[model samples]
Structure formats: C-alpha cells, structure tokens
Target: MAEHVTPPGIDIGTMHPARRYDYLLGGKDNFEADRASAETLLKFFPATRINALENRRFLRRAVTFLAREAGLRQFLDIGSGLPTAPNVHEVAQGIAPQSRVVYVDNDPIVLVHARALLTSTAEGATAYVDADLRDPARILTHPDLLGTLDLTRPVGLMLVAVMHFFPDALKPYEIVDRLVRAMPSGSYLAMSHGTFDYLTPAKRAELDALLARSGEPAAPRGRAEFARFLDGLELCEPGIVPVSEWRADDEPEPRPDPAEAAVYGAVARIP
Candidate 1:
C-alpha cells in the first residue's frame, strides 16, 4: 500500500466540501465535522441525499457515454471526490483498456486515498494531481496530468457536482471556459452542477443559510446560468436535463423526481 502524507494548510477540525460529499455518498473517509455539515444540509433540504446519489450516478453514465460511445481515450476529472466504486478510471478502462485518466482535487484526504485512483489496467494509465479547480492553469500544466493524458487528443473533462462551490466573485464560467479552451477540438465536457431551480424560495433561503453556516458557501445556479458554462461547446443529446434524466440507462422506470435531484447534467463537445 502506498502512503501520502497529509499536506500543510489542511484543517481537520473545519468541514471540507469533499469530505462532506464523501459522507453523502456513504463513504467512511469523512470526519464528524463533515458529517455535521452534511446533516445540516439534509435538515434544510431532505432531498439532498437523493440528489447526491443521482448526481453520482449521472457521473458514471456520462463517463460511460464519453468512453464507450464518444470513443474518448483520455479523461481530466477536476474536483474528483473521494474514491468510490465504479470510479472514472474503472468505468473508462472497463470499456477501453487503453483509456487514461487524471484525477484532480485539492482535498488532502483525497490525496491520501489517491492510491485507489492510481490502480489502472495494464494498457491504461492513471494519475492524481493535488490542485484546486480555481487554478485551471496549474491543473492543466501539472506533470502528472500531462504525463498520463495527451492534451492534443480528445479528453473527457468531468466536472460533476463541483462547480457550485465557486461564487460569482470567483468567475466560475471563465474558469470552465479556460479549461475547455485548453483541450482539443474533439474533447468533451461532462458536467453536473447543483441548482436551486426546484426549490421554493423559503427552502432555497434555508439551504443557502445552512451552506453559509458550514463555512463553505456554495452558489447554486439556475438553469439559464448553468447553461452558460457550456457557451462555446456543442451540447449532446438530452441536453442540460436533471441529473436523473440525462441519458439515463434506466429509462421509463419513472426517473427520480427533479425536485429531489436538483442538479443539472450534460455533455458537450469542444467543437
């Protein structure tokens, strides 16, 4: 087993977005602080757990579409959370053994468990870069990402359920645009972002308050605002629908309620 030393500037006492998400996904890599933060959100919006699960499922489906359908051989997954079953590499390598992946996240815990992400098929490759999404340049230029994936080729960029953390001041749209611009013409962007479109004004306010109290406030965008993230890219079929409805493998089975799964998912080509 490989070991990764916890880097400086990590405060375990404070709640971290990745750890909170890990707890939401039923993973044991979270602390009490993370749990408390997750519980707070659930109290305000009972559908949060369901939404998290649906968003995760959407990620798997989108990756499958990119690797198995789009024939993309490389992936650059930004803000990739704690290691979970059927991860990006597993799904992609399962379809095409030659697939390559680069997982990027700023969380120290993610780095500690990065060994799980490093396991790749004999023909494929996997690497982890400890970087923040706010710094697209750093992530794009990281040696591990560059070593594992060829930027010149079509790469699937996964940004599932992660961008909401960036507020307007951070210019999330520009950040995503910069990343998309870095990829080749055929590269695809598979994204799922949290939204308040389904919530009542009161419920939305309560959710916002809870997020602020947690010390990591997130800005849940509306449908129109979220669509702007893919401005220059060409959207794929079943465009910008709720996570549960975006090219779902289990169709006609009464998809999860959009209100419960308040996250929008889509895939777009750079061209």
Candidate 2:
C-alpha cells in the first residue's frame, strides 16, 4: 500500500472527507489536518467513532446482502473513501468471485491507493474512477466505469455515508435520480447517511452551529429527507433505520444507541 506516499497536488493542510473518515475508522492513512478536524467534530458529535463503526458495519451487511441475496454482479461505489480492509469489491467478490466493482472518489491519496484496490480475484474485476460525487454526469459517463461495469444490467449502487455531505442545496436528489435512471429495474441502491433526527433540538442546534462555524459541509438530514433519495424504489426489509440496527445480526451485542450514532441506513431496489 502506498498510503504513506503523498500524492502530488494534494493539500496536506486541508482536511478531506476521505482522510477524516479513515481517521474516524482508526486507520493511519490520515494526516494531522484530518485528525485535528475529526477531533473538533468529536467535540460536538461525541459518538463520531462509534458512528463510523456502525456505518461501516451497515455497509458490510448491505453489500453482503446485495451480492449474496440480491445476486448483483456489478457494483458502483461512489465516494469510496481511503482504501480499507473488506472494501466493496472484497465483500462482493468474496460472495461471488465474478462480481465487478467500480469505486469512485476524487481524493488524490485514494487515487494513489487505486493500485491496491484494483487487485481483484482472477474471475472478478475492479476499477477506480478519480471523480467527485457532485458530478453525476462525469461519474455516469466515465470511461473507466463504462469499461468495468455495464449499466444496462443490475448493479449495486453504493452511496454509503456520502450523501450527507451534499446538502439539499446541491441538488442531491437530482444527482441520485440521474444515477438511478441509468440502472435497470432490478438494480439496487444501498446507502447510509448521517442524521439529526434522533438528536434533541438543542443538540442539533449546537452541532449545526458548530459545523457552520467550522465550515464543515456535513448536513445531517432526517429519515424522511434521507428517504427521498430512494423515492420510487422498493425498500428492503427493516426499511430506513439506524445504521447499527440495519440487518445487525453480524454485529456483536450492545449496539450503540441510535441517538448516539444518529446515522440512517437502508437498501432499496429500483423497480
């Protein structure tokens, strides 16, 4: 892994979402800027680390369900953070070695680690697209993505823990709609998003003010608002719920409280 290698043109002083997420997940691929930002965020959202773990667990369960149960052979993982163990391709290909995955992220460091991620099972394939989630057109039309996976067939579209950064003002719903429109009827969308729905009004206000002051773009939404991204889709059992509770059999006992994590997760099939 070339994680220690600083990719050219990356700003080491600024904290990036991918690096901050890696920091939150107890990964050493982050710099001082990312750790500092995570510490500041932890001041308000004290359960930041637990939330990261719960969200990661949700991703594993959701991807396993998509690959093993839903029988999805191709995956498009938008906003895939720094290379982590049991990545989307690893999880999917483990269940079905023929599965193909295309990971999307604009982080330069993640792009550098693309070599490690691109290594797949002999029967499976993996590709990386160094693109921003904000640009749906670019992602949907990327040559790497097109070459790796066929959109006309069923695909497991993963937007896990990513949409919250894109507030309503960014036309997040429209971005999702465009991506969903390209998928076939049998395709599935699995996502997990940060939420303020479980928090007290005062706590939400404090977190909101803190983020505004810190210039963090995180916009935690309510369950209903988050579900808007899956509108017109067939919701899987256990419909939108706390990340820790979404198909949590694989998780150990003593799951974190929804109020503590405050992140919603769900998987819906495109009809």
Candidate 3:
C-alpha cells in the first residue's frame, strides 16, 4: 500500500478538531496551536478531558458489543481521528478475526497517519478513506470504502464524537440519514456527540466564543436533538445516555459524573 502524504494546503497554525481531540486525550501528535486551543476550551469547560475519555470508552464498549454480541463483522468508522490504541479494527478483530474495517477522515494529518489505521489481522482487512463527513456521497463512493466493506451486508457505522464539528447549516442529520440509508437492514449506528446540556448559559456562551476564536466552532446539541440522529433506527437497551454510563462495566471505582462527560452515546440498529 502507498503511504499517505500530508497535503500542502493544511494550516498547522490553526487548530483542527482531530488535533484538539488528540491533545485532550493526552496524545503527543498535536501541535502547539492545538494545545493552546485545548487549554482555552478547558478554562470554560473544565471537563473537556473527562468528556474526551468518556467518549473514547463509549466507542470501545459500543464496538465490543457490535462484534461480540451483535455478530457484526464489518465496520465503517467515519471521522476516525488519529490512530489510537484499541482502535475499532483492534477491538473488533480481536473478537472475530475475519472482521473488516474502513476508516474515513478528511484531516490531512489523519491522512498522513492512515497507514497506522490500515493494520489488520491476518484474517481481516482494514482501509482508510480521505474524505470529509459533509460529503456523504463522496465518502460512500470512495474506492477504499467500496473495496473494503460490502455495502450489501450489515455494518457497524461508527460515528463517535465527530458530528459536533458539523454546524446545523451542514445538515448533519441529513448526512447521517444518507449514510444510514445506504447501509443494509440490520446495520448498526454507534455514535457519540458532544452536548452543552450540562453547561450553564454563561459557560455555553464562553464555549462558543472560545471555539470561534480558535477557528473550530462546534454545534453541541441537547438530548432530544441528539436522539433525532437515530430516528429511523431501533435503539438498543439503555439508549441515549451520557458516554460514561452507556453499558459501562462494573468497576471498583465510582463512575465519573455524567455531567463531566457531557457527551451522549447510543447504539441503534436499522430494522
């Protein structure tokens, strides 16, 4: 396979959502600009790191459930950020070695690191598509996506923590609908979206200003609005809750406060 090269037009001086997320996850792949923006966001939303961690945990639990319990063998993870430990392929292929995965992201930095996400078990397959989420048609038609995943079969559509980047003008709900429509029946939608429901009006305003200043404005939704994204699908048990509490395993330590997580997650199946 060819190595991914970063495009020349990327602006390293400005913060990108994926890089900011990496910084929040304590990863070293972020630049100074991303770190600065993350620090500012932390000032207003003190639970930024907690929210990121909980979202990641939700992703893992969701994928595990799809692979082991749901008997899913294919995954389409859009807006998959920089390669992280225990990635979708890792979690899924660990349970069923024949699983196949296609990861999609538009970030040039993520493209440069796509090789890391391409690793697959001997019995499985993994590929990456360099496309934006706003263009669902382009993403669905990408050669890499078409080659790796069989659209005729059921797939686990992983949309974790990336929808907030799409402003309402982008019709994120419609984009999700398009993707879900393309998948066959019995396909699953596993997603986690950021929400401002936990923040006060003052803090929400501060968050908006911080994002605007950083050039990465987001559209955090409320519970009802977030639930609308899964409209045509059948929600699994314990639907649409804070990330930390979504089918969480019993641990010796107390779970983090749901308010600190500030992100809603759910797994729904297309009937």
Candidate 4:
C-alpha cells in the first residue's frame, strides 16, 4: 500500500452510500454506516454483488481494448471507487508500459485507498484527484489531471458504473457532453450503466424504493436514452449490449442465465 494522504476535513469513519458499495464488494475500507446500507440493498437486490462484478469485468475489458487495440495511452477514470483488483491503470499499463492514468472521485475514503493502493507503473504514471463528476471543468482543468495527461491528444474517458449516481436533475448527459467536448478527436468514452430493463415492474419498484431509502439515485435508462449520451460520437463495433455478452472471452460458452443484471456496457469514440 502507498501512503494515505486524505484531503483536509475528510473523514472515512462516517459512512456514505458509495462507501457502503465498497463494503458490499468485500472491501475492508468501509465504515459501519456503509455496511448497514449495503445490507439493506442486498435484501432488496440479492444479485447486487454479481452485478458489481460483471461491471468491473466490463471495465477491465474496455481498458484492455483501449490500450492494446486502440493505441491509447492516457486515461481519465471518473467516479473511481475504492481501488479494486485490475484497476484501470493496472490493465492499461500492463498492455503498454507507457500508459498514463488519472483517477477522479469525490469520496475521501476512495482517495485514501487510491493513494495507498494505486501505484504508477515504472514506465508510466498514475495520480488521484479529489473531485466530483458534477464539476467537469474542475476535473478537466485540475492541476493533477492536467499535469498527468495531455488533453490535446486522445485519451480514454472511463465512466464505469458511476453515472447512475447522478439523477436526471444533475443533467448527467450534459456532464458527459462537457467532458466529451473537452477531449480531442478520437477520444473514447466507455460506460457501464445500471437499468431496470431486466426486472419485473414490481421488482423494479421494490429496488427503487430500497435505493431511495439508502440515499442513492437510480438512473436506469432505456437503450435510446443511453444512446443519447453518445449522440455525437461513433460507437465502436457491437454498439451497446449486455455486459456479459460484450466481446465475451474465447472459451466454451457457459449456460446462459435468465436473470439480467440491470446493466449495459458500451464504448464510443468522439468524432
């Protein structure tokens, strides 16, 4: 682990909903409040862990593709949760030793863990920014990010399993638009979002209520709505699809499960 340098007045003891997500993922860095909230979430959606894992797998695959196939070397990972296995930097740098990565998140807990666990590869670079997604300008102009990446060139913008945190009121689409505008042409936006397309109306209602009680905003959108986020962008081959079915590994196909994990994965390039 690296050194822990938390921003001023940031406390990890008091739990937040995102922290609870870290707890539910079997991480040891979350507080009691987060644990309680995670328990409540699990009671309503028992497949929450599976959903999270699948989303994470999607993130890894996207990063790998960007580095190995797309010839991209810089990455901006917004709403980065607590550092987990095969993080963006790890996957990208593993493919190309010169890859550079900048992780952005407002959670102090995530900051602490990111500083302690996310290390820059000897041939590359990695840094953490204590910022929120709502402040895209702050993220795009922050000294840490500017110093780490070159905005004049193409960079991969990863928003894995995080946009759902922002509701319609926050103008999540506009936020994405701003970031897209900031990046140069050929930049990629890889996103994995949660949706209720797979759930029954009653079950969706039950989960929505549970999230409200847990202080989380549910932003499950249909394919059309999700596609709007990439309105001016060029979607990569295989457009948006179920995460499990997105470029699945080359091996004997496993039996398909009927239960869908309310999540969609897609990668698009700015024109």
Superposed model 3: Cα runs more than 4 Å off: 1-7
1 or 2, which is superior by lDDT?
Answer: 2
Q: Rate the local accuracy (lDDT) of all candidates.
A: 0.88, 0.90, 0.89, 0.83
Q: In model 2, which regions exceed 4 Å deviation? A: 1-3
Candidate 4 ranges with C-alpha deviation above 4 Å: 1-17, 251-258
Tens digits of per-residue lDDT for model 2 on 74-179?
Answer: 9999999988877988899899999999999998888987766568999999999989888998999999999999988999999999999997788899999999
- C-alpha lDDT of residue 98 in model 2: 96
- lDDT score of residue 186 within candidate 3: 91
**Whole-structure CA lDDT of model 4:** 0.83
Model 1: pairs clashing at backbone N, Cα or C within 3 Å:
none
Cα lDDT tens digits, model 4, 128-176, are: 9999899999999999999999999999999888887779999999999
**Which residue pairs does candidate 4 place in steric collision?**
2-116
- TM-score to native of every candidate shown: 0.94, 0.97, 0.94, 0.92
Best by TM-score: 2
- lDDT score for residue 249 of model 3: 69
| Positional deviation of residue 18's Cα in model 3 after best superposition, in angstroms | 0.7
lDDT of 2: 0.90
Error of 3 at 245 (Å): 0.4
Task: Sort all candidates by TM-score, best to worst.
Answer: 2, 1, 3, 4
Q: Rank the candidates by lDDT, best first.
A: 2, 3, 1, 4
